[model samples]
Target chain A: MLEGELLGVFALTWQAAVMLGLGGLLIYLGIAKEVEPVLLVPIGTGVILANVPLGGLTEPGGLFAVLRAAGIDTELFPLLIFIGVGAMIDFGSLLERPYTVFLGAAAQFGIFGTFFLAYFLGDGGLRLFDFSFTDAISIGIIGSADGPTSIYVATMLGSKYTPAIVVAAYSYMALVPIIQPPIMRALTTEAERRLAMPTRAQRVSRRTRVLFPILSILVVGLIAPKATPLIGTLMFGNLLRESGVVERLSRAAQNEMANIVTILLGLTVGGMMTARDFLRPETIMIYVMGVVAFALGTAAGLMLGKVMYLASGRRINPLIGAAGISAFPMCARVVQRVGLEANPHNHLLMHAAGANTAGQIASVVAGGAALVLVPFFA
Target chain B: MAEHVVEAPAPGKILRVHVEEGKPVAAGDRLCVLEALKMELPMVAPVGGTVKALHMSPGQTVEAGDPLAVIEASP
Candidate 1:
């Protein structure tokens, strides 16, 4: 019995080595490549632990499984993460330029478009990938550029592709730098990119700030009830921040609580990756679809932005429209940087930020819409 | 707390404070500057007998429908 127990302790899982390497890569990406360390670091550590020889941690009642069961399976973790993200976002950047909301809507087309493509590639016809209609829909939502919505929708839809969807969501978010610029340049001429937008004054009232979230929650909740979980958590966090009553909780959610959860969530996510689960033809397809989804989202947003630019008599920067996807500050920063590259005096951050923040809200709504629609379509 | 209603009157970065907290002021005086699309737009107190409150700060972001500073509109 003693010998058997010892043997069990060290018995190597074949994918353990591969998982360890993946973990190390995540760590390197976080530390050296500076790619979303807040999440990747914890996830990387979790991957390493889960893959270790006979860790038993991911076995029945193991640490990662427990986290998944208690938090993820219950859909609690992503909801909580939304609170932190809500607190971090500044909607004034969006509300000031209300029309940017359209850009937000435009960017979401990629979610549906990719869903269509993934479907055709999977059970729809070619049958090249392992995605069921539900999984394809969930995977395509990675285009929303939203972290929580991707996880939330994947969880709710009961898609086996949840881990890959989440990874694709977060990873593509980090890759915004690599994915967006070439597309933006390819779409617009240097002169068009150089076109300067009118500078608008910044003035958000505390009342508007407070009212915005409340109104948004009501509107979106009424429009798409499935989105309530995501929108509610997000608005609740914003309400806390704007209401000024729950400063301590908001601070904790935005800082410490978010930090702790990120670490745990990241690791748990990584734990889901066994070699069999990750290394497949379908996995490669998922990665490809993720990039395509982001690209389509960018193109759709820019197209709508062009309409806005023309309608507004060239008052709006088309580049700012690209920021309407869910990548948040990164997308907004990219738009601003690119705008400046065209014209040194060009300032698009505030405008891009407005669209980027709006993208957060729109993506949630899209997720909710997907949850409602995909079942019927499937 | 209940929400108060207000409007975005010009656009500008909030500069310095004119009225103190829990103070009274009339309309048509200087509020914050409305800076939009790179131009500084100044705003005056609108229909104000006393200052109810100011809702923004320097370097805060805002827009057209966004409320800038609120006034009691009643003495």
Candidate 2:
């Protein structure tokens, strides 16, 4: 689909060989390296499928095309993916510590911050890596650390930068372990990391559990209409989980449906990685921008955590704020790991999870805000 | 009024429902108990409240942040 002269395999072009090697690397990373292997494996396979000399597999009405039409166009894939994500999420930590909601919002600076940078780099009103107003806005959302939101926004806005944005979102998500630590440490002292939040005494009623997803769906979805599908499917999964019924369907939503959609989504994403599309000066910039976006998000969250720490009279550990970057449980785990590293007695997982879940919701809001604001800037 | 949210202390099954619906209590009150990480973590109410409703019974597994109750604020 992307423009490029078909290469002859027997007499291979260097670009084809290089791309082939890169494709192999992605597969190796997925299979052996285990870096986001769930998504990477299919993405790698798709790269191999698309890049084989004269394969025409990614051609019109081809496998990739069908996947795109069936999976992405109906927006079913992103929504389905969210169901799995919703089941995977534990909102208890977040519900216990409500203040972390603000940390989540603070971390969304990446989306807005990247928008400004991309705009300044190009049209001021904005030009970025060949991105239009919507395209750049979508690309900036890759920084939000929420995969479904990133894909949904890109698809809805019809951004030409989907592949770039997708890769950026996933790659940055995987990099949470690597990217968050330095910023967290630089922002918080060992004493701050060692801060232990007084574990609260609280009990949630069973009725509240059942009502939560329903209320969240109605409240969040109604507030942001475009986000309804995303929040709706997400809450639908949560309701299945919390309702104590339909175990079979819940298992299917969490496992079978999720696994199938993941494979399709990953490969479809990789199909977009042709040399014509991928190997550009802008590609490097997109990666760079993605890294900056992630760094900025981590910084904002950690800084705010410091602010929370001061406000709570050191009851809140600043390290937990780093979890507000939308990487889900991974970022939360990183915060927990770092907190323990600071003090073996220090356990911030629950505190950090509050921020982490908040980040998830806030990132979705940030995506919606981008949809609203970028058009204005344009 | 500040809202109180009951967060899961550990990954576990809620073994007991200690608080009854519509019962008013103090800032510190046992709401439920979760068997998690080899300990019974008593989920307590952070603020004084009339227990509005119950979301779980004994033997329900819960993760962190599943709301167990909601109390309408008493002015």
Highest lDDT, which number? 1
Superposed model 2: Cα runs more than 4 Å off: A1-12, A125-128, B1-9, B12-75
Could you report the DockQ of all the candidates, in the order they appear? 0.03, 0.06
Candidate 2 residue lDDT tens string, A1-378: 334454345645677677778778878987897888887788888887877877777788788888888888777888899998777676766776678999999999988788678766755654544756666677678778988888898888887677778878887898889988988888888889887665553666668877888888788767766667777888788788778787787788889988988988998988877777787777777788888889888898998988988888878888888888888878888887787677644557677778989899888777766666555666
Q: After superposition, how far is residue A98 of candidate 1 from its true place, in Å?
A: 0.6
For candidate 1, give the docking quality class from DockQ: incorrect
Query: What's the true lDDT of residue B2 in model 2?
Result: 50
In model 1, where do residues sit more than 4 Å from their true spots? Answer: A1-10, B1-75
Interface RMSD of each: 10.2, 8.0
Can you write out model 1's per-residue Cα lDDT over A1-378, one digit (the tens) per residue? 566457744566656677789889988999998899888888788878877766778888989889988888888888888999888776777777788899999999989999999989999889988788898898889999887788888888888878878888898999998899999998887877888665555556899999988888899999898999899999988988888888998898799877777877887888877666776778778889999999999999999988887898877778987998989888977886787677654557677878998898999999999988865777
Residue-level error in angstroms, candidate 2, position B63: 9.2
* Chain B: TM-scores of all predictions: 0.68, 0.79
Instruction: Name the candidate that leads on TM-score.
Output: 1
